[model samples]
Target: MNFSYSFPALRGIQAGREFYTVMCPLRLIPKIFLFDEEEIPAEHRAQRVMNRSRIPDITNYILENPKDYIFSSLTASVDGEMIFQEHSEELKDIGYLTISLDSKFLINDGQHRRAAIEEALKVFPELGEETISVVFFHDLGLVRSQQMFSDLNRHAVNTTSSIGILYDHRDQLSLITKALISDIPLLNRYTDREKVNLSKNSPKLFALNHIFNTNCRLLGKRKGEIISEQEKEFANQFWVLLCNTITEWQEVLNKKTSPRDLRVNSIVAHGVFLEAIGIIGYYLYFYHPDEWEKYVKKLKHIDWQRDNKEDWQGRAYSHTGRINKNNETVQLTANLIKKKIGLPLTEHEQKIEDKLKEASPLGT
Candidate 1:
C-alpha cells in the first residue's frame, strides 16, 4: 500500500502544457522537494550545481529579517503520477492535486531559497507555519527541464550597481552617500544617480555607485556597519571641503568650466580619482585629524591634467593612457596624493611604489 500527498492548487496552462500552483508550508519544503546531489557531469544534470558559498548569506538574510523578508515563488517538476480533483464543473481549474509518496521532485529554480528556508526553520521553528507558493510542472525529461531553466533565465537582467545604491535603505554607506549628494551643492549639481558609466557627453562628474564606494573607503567602514551621527556629519564635511579644495571640482561648481572639458582633460574627473581621494581622506581624517584642512588644500596644487604622464601614467591611467580602476591603480593614485600632501606611505604602499620604480627607473 502507498500513501499520497495532496495540496489545494490552482491549475494553469502555458505553451499547451498544464501546471499547478500550490501553497506549501515552509516546514514541508525540505521533506518533499529534492535537488540533484549526485556528482554527475554538467550535461547529465538538469540544474546547475549548488553554490554552497551563497547559502549562508541568504540564510542570514532570512533569519535577520524574519518579519519582512520576501521571496518569489519556487518552480519545480514532479516525476510521477498526479491526480487533480475538481471542486465543480465550473471551477475545474481550482482544485486539489494528489501525488503518490513515491514520486521524485526536482527543483527547477529557487534552490537557494529552499536551502535558506530549511536553515531558518532550525533556529525559528515558529516560521514553519508560514507558506510559500510553489509552481509544479509535470515531469518532463532532462532535456525539457534544461530548456525550461534556460528559458526562465534568458531575459533576466541584473540591476546596475548605481541603481542598487540609489534604492538601498539598509546599508548605512548607501544612506550616507545619498544624504551627502543631497546636502553638498557640488555633488547635488554634478553626480549621476542612476547609471554607473557616464557616456562621453553626459555632463555628470561622478556616478552614484562611485561616490558610495568612496564613502565606504573614507569612513573605513564595512558595507552594513551602523554609523553614528558624528560620522555622518564628518563625511558631509569631508566631501564639502573636497569640493572646495579640488581645482577642477570648484571650477565645475562655479560654472567656469564644463564637466565634459574637465572629464576629457583631467584624470580627477574619473571614479578612480574619487576612490584615490577617499583613501587620502581616510588618512587625513584619522591620522592628521587636527590639521587635515591644511593638507587637503594642497590637492589644488597637484597637476590634474590627463597628459601629466610623469605623475599619472601607471597610477591613474594605464601605460596605454586608458583610465584603470583596478586595486593597484587606485593604490598608486592614492600614493601620489599622499606624496603631494607630505604624508608618509604605508609599508605595503611603499613596496608597490618600489616595484613601479624598478620597472620604470626614469619615472617614464
Candidate 2:
C-alpha cells in the first residue's frame, strides 16, 4: 500500500493554535499481511449489524478523508511488540479499508466506523479491494472492550427518537396493532386523531407505551440490562388487558342511551372502567382470544348504568383526568359489570381457560 508518509497527530486544535508536533513522526512504515477474514471471528465482529439500506453520510466522510481520522497511539502494540507490518502486493493493490487487530479498544470504540465499513463494503465490492491501515492490540480483554464500546458510543448527543424506536421494532408493533385494529370493528373506520388518541388514551396503548419506554430506560442504564422474562410476561398480560378493555368500551359506547364523552368523562369513571377491563382483557387475550371475542359481542345485549339517563346525570365534567379516582360518575350495573368485566361469567371464564390451552409454557 502506498501509505501516506507524513503521519500527523491531531489534538483539539483551536482557532488561533499554531501547528504542533506529530505523535509518531517516528513512523512504523506500513506493510500488509494476507487478508484473513478468520483473524477476527464473525461472532465477535460487531453488534446489531444489519444490512442498511443507505450508506450513512459519516461513512462517506471517513472514506473520502481517511487522513482526518485519528487513532489511539498505543493501539499499534500487539503482545508488547508493534504489529505494524509492511504492505504486501495484494494489500497495496486495494488500500482503501484497514483492520484494527491491534486495538480491540479501537474496534470497540469505532463500532460505528466498523459497522459502516462492513455494510458499505457489501454493496461496494471495490472496498474489499482496498487495504487501509488498522492498529490492533492483542491483549485487550473483554472488560476493556466493553468499556471502550460504552465510552465510544456515549457521546453527548446519544438520544434516539420516538419514531426511530417505533421503526426499530416496527415488525412486532405493526403486527400487534394490525391484529387489534382488525378484530375491533369500531376501529375499522379509524381516524388519525382517533388513532393518535387510541395510542394516547386507550389503556392498552398507555400500558404498552409505559412498558416499552421503561424497558428502553432499563437498557439505557447499562449496556446489557434488557427486559427479563418475567417483565416480558407482565407486559404481554398488560397488552391483552388493554386491547380487550378498548374493545369492550367500544361495545359499551355502542349501547349508550345518551351521547358518549371519552374526553369530558370523569377520570375516576374512566380509570375504573379501564383498570377493570384491562384485568379481564389481559387474561382473555391469551387464554381465550376467540371466546373473549364472543364475550365482547355480548356486551351490546345488556344495559349498563351509563346507558340510563338518570344514572349519568352530572357524571361528566370539562376535563378528563389522570388521577382523582374519587369523582363519582355512575356505578356500572351489577348485571352488566358481571357480564362485561365480572363473573358466573362462564363466557368470561371460558375465555381465559381456552386461552390457557393455547398459550405456550412461559419462561426464559
Using TM-score, give the best candidate's number.
1
| Candidate 2 C-alpha RMSD relative to the actual structure | 15.6
| lDDT (Cα, tens digit) per residue for candidate 1, span 80-148 | 989889989999999999988998998998898999899999999899999999999998899999998
lDDT of 2 by residue, 1-364 (tens): 2333333222222233221222332112222111113446644643224334444754564465454533332322122222233246655322222223332222333334444555555555455544334444343454544454455456836333333333343233333334444454433333221222233344322222222332332222222234455444444444444344443355444654111343234221233444334444444545664566555445444433433433222222112323222212212222234444334444544454345345525410
Query: What is the lDDT of every predicted structure here?
Result: 0.89, 0.36
Instruction: Estimate TM-scores for all models.
Output: 0.95, 0.30
Candidate 1 residue spans exceeding 4 A from truth: 361-364
Candidate 2 TM-score, C-alpha based: 0.30
The top-ranked prediction according to lDDT is 1
**Candidate 1 accuracy as TM-score:** 0.95
